[model samples]
Structures are given as structure tokens and as C-alpha cells.
Target: MMLTCIAVDDEPLALRLIANFIEQTPFLQLVGSYSSAAAALRGLQQQTTAVDVLFLDIQMPDLNGLELARVLDKGPGTDKPRVVFTTAFNQYALEGYKVDALDYLLKPFDYAEFRRVADKALAYANATRPTAAEPALLPQEDYLYLKVEYQLVRVDFRDILYIEGLKDYVKVYRQSEARPLLSLSSLKSLEERLPARQFMRIHRSFIIALNQVKSVSRSTVQIGSATIPVSDRHREAFDQFLSRWK
Candidate 1:
């Protein structure tokens, strides 16, 4: 059966590329391409059709993929499509898992691996919906443990947006109504501690949630209309991340 899919990414090129790839892949039928999570939700809400898989990019302007996944779970559909996250960073892997994502692809992943992951997701998307007795229907938890005030804290993985360097201190952005920017210790030092799957070093200064960003191109990441520069050193990985979207 053709697995119907809708890809949501921030880059126009990435969306076009996925569309092209869908055309060639017999198992996947391209349902739509959305430049932002908001756009995808609008179309999906129109109640026009059903999709089997989601090729989702994490970071976006209005609604990021993780949040979008949570939204989809509440939709009228009895069962939701399998979600596969496409991102450049590795730090958010645990969080993606928390969102019940089928798989997480690091930026610049090999095309062969992508196909492999896609195949698995297709099978899951087509599997029988969880029955009331099945625990798979429960919301999965993704969190990072932290020691604060003589106690351990279980922070929901998706609460973070960015963690900034502050000499010796680290500030974590948590579940605030608005996206939070945090202060943190040395960027390099913190990078070592982050989960390799969910976080990536896009620049010497910034550690973005692999699933939080909206989109990217050769030059910049779209933060609003402003373009955030992609460091020359990170170009290769960034290009690879962008290629899958293509």
C-alpha cells in the first residue's frame, strides 16, 4: 500500500526535495509539503484526507514539530500517523522519543539510513491502533534529570528552546508560554553533557533543539525573518540536514 505522507519543514528547497523524493519512492505518496508547522496543521485540520506518515522538522516559527505531534494525538482521527523527526542536532533525541516519535535522524544522516528508518515508520504507521488496554496509547515522557536545591528535577525534554553560556553558570529554558532563552555554563562544556541524539552544535555559540528549529538554508536558520548564520565549520552537517528536506 502507498503510505501517504506530508512533510513539514522550514526550507522551501527542503520541501521541494522531499516532494521530489516522494515522487520516486513507490511506497510513499506525497500528500502535501508545508513550510511551517502552522501551515501543516491548517491543511490537516480541513478534514480533507488522511496521512500515514509525517516527515517532520523540529524547529519552526509558530509551532515546532514536537508540539505539533502532541497536537496530532488529540485530533479527531482515531489513530495518528507515525512521526519521524528530521533535524541537524542530536541533543533532542531523548525528547523526540518522549514525544513518541518513531525515529530520530541526526543532521547529515546517510540516505540509506533514512530509507531504513522511513520503512520502519511506515510499518508502525500502518500497524493496528492501540487498543484501550494497550499502554502504547499513553503519553511518553522525555526528560533530563537535574540536581537543584538539594533535590532532583525531572524537566520535560521539550521545555527547552536554547541554553546560553554564562561563564560558569547554566540557565535552562523550561515550559514557559513564550519560548525561553536560558543562561548556562561554557557552551563547549555543556555540549559534552547533552544527549548526543537530541542536541547538535550548529555554531560555536548556539546549541539548538534539533526538534525546535523551523527551517534552514545554506546561509542561515530562519528565526522569524531574521537569518541566523550557519557557521562555515558546520556547513557540511547543515547541508546534509537540509538535503533530506530537499
Candidate 2:
């Protein structure tokens, strides 16, 4: 099922960008576009159809996105549309999540980031609604849910470079990200969930993505300049795999 959405931004360029993004996505349908929060509120009140998501800009002349979100929260029933806050300021991110926003997009974001948030909104929308006899929209299987602090963060499998075990926790290193994601999860538990063909546990504390391995030696493997040790227990298996790979 297509998820209905609306964009509200005082800036014409930003509003147009979000609208275009919504139109380009197969699962998202742009139902409304408003220049201000007050106008968006009025439009939403008049609409007979339910909006599944809102791409809202936090700063505006009056009735800012956060205020509008509060108003919607107290409006009527619990079927309120999920919010995804968009703003240039990073300060509002904590506030946005406190209001239970589905996602947050910073200004100057590309279509790829927008699409990621859209997918999250779609998954949330479908999960909350009643199941229909018709087959539901199939969610993409290329992602993994990692519990980061109090929230479950969706991380794409392709983005993962390696995972390092730290006692009861694991640090997930990604391709482009400078800092790894720290989760209260064991390496053994995550190893079970990872695709065996794509991932390999080369040491007691480390699991590396096979395809991300840039180079290998008798005792170590390199991924994007990060050298990870291959323990004696796993060296034979790694050598066997390398022989087959060669």
C-alpha cells in the first residue's frame, strides 16, 4: 500500500525538493504541500484521507513544526501521522526524537537520505495499520536492526565494514561513518544473524565482512586501512577460504 505524505516548509526550494522526492518514491504519495504550519494544519483538517507521514521543517514564521506536532498529538485520536523533522540546525534532533519523530533529515540532504527516511515511514505506517487481505508492501531485506542505546536503529548490511566485540557490547563499523555504532549486543549473537557468505568471524572479538576485506596476511586482514587480527583458532578456516578465493 502506498503511504500518503505531506511536506510543510516555508522555503519554496526545500518544499519543492521534498515534494519531488515523495513523487519519485514508488511507495510514497504526496497528498499536500503547505508553506506554513498553520496552513498545513488547516489543510490536514479539511482532508478526508489520512496522511501517513509528514516531512516537516522545524523553523517557520508561526506555529513551527514542533508546535504543530504537539497540536496534532493532542488533536483527537491516536492515529496521528508520524513526523520526520527537517532542519539545518542539529540542535533540534534531540527534541525531534523526544516528540517520537520517525526520522530527522538535515538540510542539504540528498535524495538517498530522503528515501531512507521514507522507507522507515512506510515500514512504520504498515506496521501500525490493520492487516489487509491484499499482500502488504514487502520491506527491503538489506537492512539490520541494531539496538543503539534505547532505540533500535536500522543499519543497511551493505554499509557495514566490520564488527568488534567489547565484552557484552559490539561496535559496528560502517563504510563512510567515522564512528562505529555501539550496541549492547554480543558478537556471537550478531554473527548468527549475519549472512555467512558475506561475513566471517576471524577472531574472538571481531567479525569482518568478506567482501570488504582489502588485503590479508598470515595473522591479519585489512579493511579500508583498518588492520584486524585473525586469531589462531580461525586462521586455518581463513586460509582455506583464501585458497578457494584465489
Candidate 3:
């Protein structure tokens, strides 16, 4: 399968070069190329098709590549792309891997060097993709098990107040609980399991139980004492839910 990819760089020359490489590659399809990290973020969030790979330059003006990668990783999507960092300095290589980067390409890299990393990304994409025999989503259930530290804790859907995403972990706040139950999972992962009618992701960091919401404003959702902001990206869906309730 051709891996769908995007390249982001502040320098026009660098961005053009990366775009050229992506177009020339047989297994890679260049979907979009952005001159800034912010533009890339917006494009990825709104795009309907899932991107398999991201070719990013580490240093940029407002939002750097590493920061952008983290945002995409924790953002409201299940198909998080494999990142390949491109930078002039090799110093950022260690930080790149912390965000689970597929590979690092130092600046002034030739077409041969770029192709090697592209090969690595292709191999990874092939390995992780789900086969026809393996279903992506399982049958929905009332309660789901979460890994809290070393123990597996079960949380019921009806009892859940809301869920918070912090980097790689999620905090599940349930009814009558003073402290939330922490789990080693992404909001996107949990989102897939939760019943759509009962829960809604109001923000990048929060997923609220629809039935438990006390009130909702133009930009926020109230659940008990906690108020969750409805992100601009998710506002339309939140508005639609309000219309349905009306």
C-alpha cells in the first residue's frame, strides 16, 4: 500500500525538496506540504483521509516539529502518523525518539539517505496495519478494563464522569470519586471503545459523559463541578449534540 504522507518546513527550499522526494518515491504519496508547523496541524486535523507518515523539520518559528508531533500524537485522531524528523542539527535526535519518531534525517541529506528512512517508515506501516482477519474495533460493552499502574481496573460506562488525556496516559474520573483512575492509554484508544451516544470528546484533552453533563455553553461543557472547554475543532459536533437535545 502507498503510505500517505505530509512534509512541514519553514524554509521554502527545504519544504520543496522534501515534497519532491515524497513525489518521486514509489511507496509514498505526498498528500500535503506546509510551510509552518501550525498549518500542518490544521491540515491534519481537518483532513478526512488518514496520514501514515509525517516528514517534519525540528526547528521552526512558532511551533517546532517535536511539539507538533506531540500534539498530533495526543490529538483527536486514531490514525497517528509515524514521524521522521529532519533537521540540520543532530542534537534533536534523542528528543525525536521520545515522541516515538520512526527515524531521524540530518540536514543536507541526499536522496539516498532520504530513501533509506522512507524504507524504514514503509516497513513500519506494513507491520502495524490491521489485516482483514483482525477487526479494528471489538463489540462494545458496559465496562472496560484499564491498566492503572500494574493492576487492571474495571470502569463502568454509566459511572464515568469524564476522561482526561495527558500525553500518553488518561485519567478516568468516575462518579463519587475524589481522585481519578489513571490508565496507560490514549483518549483516541478509549474513544473507540466508549459508546458514542453516552460519551463525547468535547476537547483535545477531555471526553465527557453526555448523560452526566449538567450544562453546556457556547465554548464549554459542565459536568458536576468540572467545566470542560469545547475546542474549535470539536465545536460543530458539540453543537449538533445540543441541537439533538433541543
**Lowest summed lDDT window (length 10), candidate 3:** 133-142
- Candidate ranking under TM-score, highest first, comes to 2, 3, 1
Question: Residues 1-246, candidate 3, lDDT per residue (tens digit)?
Answer: 689999999999999999999999999999999999999999998889999999999899999999999898777756899888889998876576557677888898899999999887765655446557653224455777665643346678899999999997899998968899977678998998898988898889999999998888899988889988999999989999999768
List ranges where model 2 is wrong by over 4 Å: 134-246
Once fitted onto the true fold, the runs of candidate 3 whose alpha carbons sit more than 4 angstroms away are 133-246
Q: What's the CA error at residue 236 for candidate 3, in Å?
A: 46
| Candidate 2 lDDT tens digits, 1-246 | 799899999999999999999999999998999999999999999889888899999999979999999889768875688888989998986566546677789999999999888877776655445575533222434666775643567777789999999986899999878999998778997887787877899999999998898888889999997999999999888998789767
Error of 3 at 4 (Å): 0.4
| lDDT, candidates in the order shown | 0.67, 0.85, 0.85
Number of backbone clashes in candidate 3: 0
lDDT of 2 at 103: 79
| Alpha-carbon RMSD, each predicted model | 19.9, 10.9, 11.3
Q: TM-score, each model? A: 0.50, 0.56, 0.55
